[model samples]
Target: MKAFRLEELEAQRAANQGAYLQFLRERNMSVGLYALDAGQADPQQPHGQDEVYFVVSGRASVTVGDETETVARGSVVYVPAGVVHRFHHITEDLKVLVVFSPPES
Candidate 1:
């Protein structure tokens, strides 16, 4: 089995210097790390594949479609494909795990 370390992914993300850093890609799904600084804006647009987000740390509010909700560590959210979604009003540095089914195109 393949093993992944968070510290390693964090290092990779720092090197990439991107809001999202993809770590794994398979035919069925893709996994990535998403980070947003406090008071930062998420610039992502709607995706074609269904997605799942798991908050790894910090606090923020996510708007999915027309609904918005607060999220923090241990929070999990599901967003259907073609839905508008983004995180805003970040009260603290946000770290999230993102999964895209059928892999992201």
Candidate 2:
């Protein structure tokens, strides 16, 4: 079994000066943490693998293709491969747990 501590990971993230901190990876799946401050832009593009985002904290809205929806703590979202999506108009800092299937290449 593997255990990961959020605070520890966050500290590592800060030390690395990166926006994403991947904690686990396997053949079929991978997990990472993505942090964005309020009013910051999400610098991401459409991925080739399916993705699931779980909002650990904060407030924002995500636009998947043409549809947009509000998200906050406890919000779960799914996006299929090759779909354009991004979080915008962040009213609060966001910490999102991201899961990628087929282990994003």
On lDDT, the leading prediction is: 1
What CA RMSD would candidate 2 show? 0.7
lDDT of 1 at 98: 95
Candidate 1 residues 69-92, lDDT tens each? 999999999999999999999999
Of candidate 1, the 10-residue stretch with the lowest lDDT total is 1-10
Total clashing pairs for each candidate:
0, 0
Q: Candidates' lDDT values, in order?
A: 0.95, 0.94
Query: Residue 7: error of model 2 in Å?
Result: 1.0
Give the TM-score (vs. native) of candidate 1: 0.97
Cα RMSD (angstroms) for every candidate in the order listed: 0.6, 0.7
List candidate 2 segments past 4 Å from native.
none
In angstroms, how far off is 60's CA in candidate 2? Answer: 0.5
TM-score of each model, in listed order: 0.97, 0.97
